[model samples]
Target: MSGCMSSSDESDVSACNHEDQGDASPMEIPADDLATSDEDEEASNPPPTKKQKTLESKKPKTPSQIKKSTVKVGGKCSSTNCSKKALQGGHCFEHGGGYKCSEEGCTKQAKVRGKCVPHSGGNRCTQPDCTKLARLKGLCIAHGGANVCSFQNCTKTVQSKGKCIDHGGGKKCSKRGCHNQVVSDKLCFEHGGGN
Candidate 1:
């Protein structure tokens, strides 16, 4: 029989008998290279259990990955170029997100109770005989639901900075060296305000 040893039937019997080993003398391993015992070998290089192997196969994910996975529903709208809040189905009402209005032939987003604003979808004013939309405290803007102007003896609603536009409360003209209030398109009456 050939001196080369078969891979099978080899039990704790090591020798330079492989086909590629040739006539070289048996390899000598230093005493320091051997493990002290089976216990030391197990501790140093233990085979992973089924559970451990499963876990090892899975790589740890980052915090952003975890967060993105959790945002499957009720997060930011998924529609393109839309940054509005999401209601359901991962989209905003304007971008076909939430429930559509209940009125027939109406595709607008529902404001309240499955209806649009024009179809009486929102809360009505609580004041007697008032059919206008409620603004604050169950009342409409004309019924004291809005803030009044802060100018002396001024009862008009505030346009900005607690004052009406008549008292210089709105945005000013964008023209250089012009302090006049904007009448149209950010320009004063003298600078293409009507246009």
Candidate 2:
């Protein structure tokens, strides 16, 4: 057989002269010949340019380098004692971090001024004459706070209803026509009641 092979199977074969054989089976070149051809191709090609060699030698930046690049130069937490990076509104997530209550002396986190719920700080009663903290309804206990007795004109604190035990709010005397409150017995102290 002639050393020349068909073009279809050996289109990449630059070192061989293969004549076109229409619809012929592909020729299998020896492994040693293939290696020699590869070596010859490498020798013929020019070496990489200086810039290409430099780019190939360069490595990707390390994690520390990336972190340093992202670090802020002068940015810091708003809190005087804090040294951490500021995440929002010039403050760290730990010290005065989130949105704070607009009320004076209140450090609670709040979305709006009206809805600022006190977490640790106490809110003053809405009553102008009161200086105590408000428990509910914007007023202290003396100024119509929550959890008061449900009885009319009753200002005492409550166990359940708005009325104190003395005002028939809790368990009352079992005796007929007796409105006195009871202790542990079904009757009051005046009605032979004792626990």
Candidate 3:
């Protein structure tokens, strides 16, 4: 009878110890080794960084800002070359960054648009007779390229009624002996009369 009572007492003590241990888990720690919390981590990591904020583009690094460089007044890559200025985005034709011409002597930047001038209607080249790019209509101003039509070169200027020679003024075609309605665009009947 005494042995049975002692066994009951020992079992009770063992069950109580187990229940206490189950309530308090071993892994339930509150980040004891973490010297600081999230607030401190953010404070030390920083945001956009010092130099990253100065760049102008929405994207972090623009092509012009590459190689950590700047341009000079007389045309030279101010980063380290000390020679003639390369293009701000990449290398211009003269500086030799490997881009083909839109046409002859046209050193406009070559984008997917595929011209030295990007979107100037191919007028990116500032030279007087160097209308090399066809940005708007696949051609430039000179050499019978995009007629612009707002100005007065070909009677094909078709904005208003009196605008195009063919549709309005009945001007003769500038080509040899073909006298049709010379509208803002200079194509014959078979060509898109540009009416």
Candidate 4:
């Protein structure tokens, strides 16, 4: 009985070895073929190097490097010497083209409400009950719209100021006793102010 059991166990081990060999054979054959194919592909088409890619991206595009980027609108502007694209009325925006204001006697181009800003009351003052066009700070001129001098009680309009030029707002001339305003380099126009 011991001899019979040993023979059966040997047969079982041999069967398992055969099954393993069969599975390994198929797997190994495909793996080898795939590696060879990948090597062939790499040899045929080498990828661009980092330096080559960088140089290609840095290259500037020329006028005729390709084709016109904008889609062909089939026609050009009606104005002579103008090469701009034409809108629906065969004219460009600068050439009095595009939808006009729908308001009676208003020939200006319409932005909204079928009328221009002035006629349509667009950009009105933010001040309560104020209908004037907004000039600055969402307010009209009477509502402190423009920037004024920073000096006390000074009403002069300025880019920025402690006072207006007459009251020493800007840099004065560097010449001794010169009251003229400085143009550049701390010198007045007559004193060779930096041209």
Instruction: Name the runs in model 2 displaced over 4 angstroms.
Output: 1-124, 147-169, 192-195
**lDDT, residue 157, candidate 2:** 84
Q: List runs of model 1 lying over 4 Å from the truth.
A: 1-118, 174-185, 188-195
C-alpha lDDT (0 to 100) for residue 76 of candidate 2: 53
Worst 10 residues of 1 by lDDT: 61-70
What would the TM-score be for candidate 2 when compared with the true structure?
0.26
lDDT of 4 by residue, 1-195 (tens): 334446658776555655666756423655788899999999999999999875643333222332342322324555577655544344554554445666777666565675666677667788899876777888866677777777778776654365666567777889998876775578775575633
lDDT of the candidates, in the order given: 0.62, 0.55, 0.45, 0.61
Error of 4 at 65 (Å): 26
Candidate 4 weakest lDDT stretch, 10 residues: 60-69
Please give the clash total of every predicted structure, in order.
0, 6, 13, 0
lDDT of 4 at 138: 88
lDDT of 3 at 145: 46
TM, every model: 0.35, 0.26, 0.24, 0.26
Please write out the lDDT profile of model 1 over residues 1-195, one tens digit for every residue. Answer: 144344454542344343344554457444555745656888989898898865632322222222222233444556566655555544555544556666778766666665667785478889999887898888889898888898899888887898877777778878887776675577765675533
